[model samples]
Target chain A: MSGAKPKLTTSAMIASLAAEGHRTSGAPFGHALVALAQTRLDIVGMTADLAKYTDLHVFAAAYPDRFYQMGMAEQLLMGAAAGMAREGLVPFVTTYAVFAARRAYDFVCLAIAEEKLDVKICCALPGLTSGYGPSHQATEDIAIFRGMPNLVIVDPCDAFDIAQAVPAIAAYKGPVYMRLLRGQVPLLLDEYDYRFELGRAKLLRDGADVLVISSGLMTMRALEAAKRLEADRVGVAVLHTPTIKPLDEATILEHAAKPGRIVVVAENHSVNGGLGEAVAALLLRNRIAPPFHQIGLPDAFLAAGALPTLHDRYGISTTAVAERIKSWL
Target chain B: MADPSTVSRRSNVSLAQRAWRIRRNALRMAAVQGQGYIGQALGVADVLAVSYFHALRYRPEEPLWEGRDRFLLSVGHYAIALYAALIEAGIIPESELETYGTDDSRLPMSGMASYTPGMEISGGSLGQGLAIAVGVCLGLRRKNVNAFVVNLLSDGELDEGATWEAAMSAAHWRLDRLIALVDVNNQQADGPSSRVLGFEPLVAKWESFGWHAQRVDGNSIPALVAAFDAARALTEPRPRVILCDTRMACGVDFLERREKTHFLRVEPDEWDAALAALGEMPA
Candidate 1:
């Protein structure tokens, strides 16, 4: 019943751990979705009793009457959302990444994705964000959902991107599987004044020496790697793409085709069919031959660990990203 | 169609010919496709005939009307019965029935809302349609609308745990606006449901779950009309359930005689005989 911004914000914690300038994408997506619900009547929200965790509580608070609490039934949660969508209401159904990706894939496939209904499935804790071990980490989420047809997958990088992408999704007409980065997230993206477009990638920086292509939370690490590598006399340009599916082949190929430039695809997802596989497919189909390195988790289920320890263990840190780029060079 | 309460005031004799016509249409549709779940389809033809001809409040010209009582066929394989009933209801033409299951036909083997009219939900995955029907009930109830929800399910489909979860929720919420009719045809895809999952004492299960339950001979038009009329009569704080005990191939001679007619391929030679067997029989 009270609104108080804690002095110990997530951005403050990030400043203490990493540096003064870093951003998170979680809370902004929650806030933007609330603002979107004001003008868009069709936007209805539901969660599997994780309203606070997924940050959809923002929308729930504004439109309490429209929200449905499907109490931990992830499959029914998705099915109910699809049912509401079938009735011409745009339902934003939220749950953890593991449940949405693994437990309810068939329901999502048959009800929402295959039927081509307009259900916005917002999933929290993609990859190793939740170090609750294999049970919580959804490292294989992108691989599973990407193989399904007619589903738009978006992995926003920072708070600014989440805020922008939320309104974009409300405008989009088909089904979308969005990865959430919840809770007092960092604010590194406000520096670039980034904008979001579904299935369209953004070009953050342009450098012919090397192309660091990254999406989702990994884009933050890629930007840091670019800054650190600049001090070492290696010119690098970071291209931050929050949209993974219907990937920005024009921009990806544009940078990959640049003469004497090496491409490094970075993601928090697995090696197979993640952003790495998607971009690789795009390059191969276009015949844009370039030296490429995939920076992502190996083909194994990650065990439970601390969030920071997990990111480091999986080689998704800025240091590991810098090392991958150095090896390609 | 007339209001169910008003239709129930008349005797089932008025609907005898319509029930036979629905059964005849179901057999022909299956015969044209050379295959269908006609056994299950035939089993539910009487109820569908009563609902389409005399009970449900709907307009054939307006399938998506807001005031219509929603009817969802939860078991998608029994779409032959739904297609036949929809055609009889005038939501679709008799000519389009020939295109059922063909490459470009709206009437596929399973029900899809995008392809067909009057299909409230896309079904095939068992135990899915009832939950959506619950959603429809909740949606209409919230608006203070006096609409009813009816979902046709199979005994075999009860093996799905989601159906029980939805059943518990519907009864606990006292969804008087909702009703579940079980097509208890005994036989399933592999064998009898009794041998497969053993859904014995089905009426007791519904009673224990807090639903007003009853059993009726599903093949009898008069019995089906009366059972549904009884379901509509309840105004208490619990949903009602009708257990429809029926033979696998209720209306056809060849299909009913065979033990392996669950997913029968009605051969070209057997089509005319199957149609003739169901031609004049009052379902």
Candidate 2:
């Protein structure tokens, strides 16, 4: 009974991603933005009635005069963000990832990306991070926006990454689509003293048995999987690529080119357009064909359930990743 | 190099003269493409003329000056019209008009903010400009920059739900610096804008959204000038809107008589005739 785990509660459906005992940072994006805005007078925050959900309420409270509550219109939110960018204010736009990628795609494409405005589109509940099923799951957001010109995409892994990415994207000249991890984000990378660079991939752990190239929360999962796999003598190297677009090609090619390691692209997105295909294409183009594999969500609408069940079912959880890697080995 | 449009930026020229120049510039730009949103350009010429030549404060040399007033052309097809005004305002050189719609041309068929100097936002996707203007107004207020933002969207754009969303936001934010200009030319791709989806009681609808709405004949230079002036004169918390009821292919009599002028494709011989018709009022 002491060793056995408690039953997963309904709260697991919308619980924080932070594992028990591991330190969690409270709304890194919101806090970082509030700090960055103190000096950068042009930094403005905006949301489409998702302030509290996306953790923009923190910034809203800090700078009530600078925050714009655009209500439920995602198109208007993106359109307004683009407009604010044009007027020389860097707008951090927050909403559900599904809303930004699916609902207001054309607006984001034409207004922000096309114009190359300095608008930070940070959306909450990326991929299966939301257990609200297909309605909330932005499983195809990366695939949807991967082809857009002038858009630099970021998928941060933890609170540390989110905190660093806030000012980095703000300092960046053009448009950025960042998958935000809000509400007690895991401060995982801080253990490794990792710094978030805009387009560079960080190699968190070195292993000869397998190379796990991952982004977003999947990277955190990959790190955990790496630690567990180490006990089995199945060395798992985790490459944390927060920036999805302008794929840290040199770093990826360098790692994938290494022989004897089974290179697997693990992502929280669909197997379709997200980082998996991107890495596969990059490897193929470079002719660095190692024993390749991918651990990702299926190209289908996920069922409504607890996120832990969903992650395990979809084969993106830490245990699932470790099990899949062992099977591949 | 010696274009009157460039020189006309100086106040020596009358608004009527400036409007004439804008129409000519648009026609010339259309001549390059052979087919475009020419009817829209022609109809919206008066508004563009007033905006660039009178209402907006912008430096020809520095189009992105932070303090300058902004003009958002929501309808990208009306790039010919806005480009014409830009050329007249000396923002874009007259030589660029010759390359309109070409592969390497800065003056593409649609208005792109990145390509053009004074083009504030890339507008082709309708119903987005008003929202962008609302943002710009909010930004200006935040920076405490005393500059007005004019969003010129077509009547067809009113059919978009985002426009109404922006309308509500502008009022909610108390963005007095925002001015929405609706070019109610009553022509859309499918059919007439009114019949396509009638935004009837248009002024009343805008008023309901807490805007200072005004309906005026858009082709009349005097009417447009007065509306623009009245819009600026008000320092109220409510955003201002000028619903300009305009005629498609205005000034070009023979083209105006044609039913489908949404994307007017003038006959090869009629380009000169249209230009000539633009010169003299239909009498």
Per-residue lDDT of candidate 1, residues A1-329 (tens digit): 77875333122111212334553344676789888888887778888888988888888888888887777777777776776776678889899988999988877887788788899999888876775668887898999998899899999886777888898987999999999887867667778856788877777876667888998888888888888888877888788878888788898887788888888889989998799988888899999878888999889978665555556668888787887787778
CAPRI quality of model 1: acceptable
Tens digits of per-residue lDDT for model 2, B116-224: 9888888989888998898888877877898989999988898999999999999898888888899988888888876889889998999999999999999998999
Per-residue lDDT tens digits for candidate 2, residues A1-329, read 49777655445334688777878989888999999999998888899999998899999999998888889999999988887887678899999999999999999999888878899999999998877789899999999999899899999999989999998988889999999888888887988957999999999989989999999999999999999988999888889999999899999999889899999999999999999999999999998888999999998989887778778889998889999999998
Error of 1 at A173 (Å): 1.4
All candidates: TM-score = 0.91, 0.94
Q: Report lDDT per candidate.
A: 0.80, 0.88
Per-model chain B TM-scores are: 0.92, 0.94
Cα RMSD, model 2: 3.2
Off by over 4 Å in 2: A1-9, B1-12, B280-283
Weakest 10 consecutive residues, lDDT, candidate 1 chain A?
A9-18
Off by over 4 Å in 1: A1-26, B1-13, B142-145, B172-174, B279-283
Cα lDDT of model 1 by residue, B111-219, tens digit: 9878899987778898886666666666666566677788889998899876776777677557897888898887777887888899889999999999999899887
Native-interface RMSD of candidate 2: 0.8
Q: Clashing residue pairs, candidate 2?
A: none
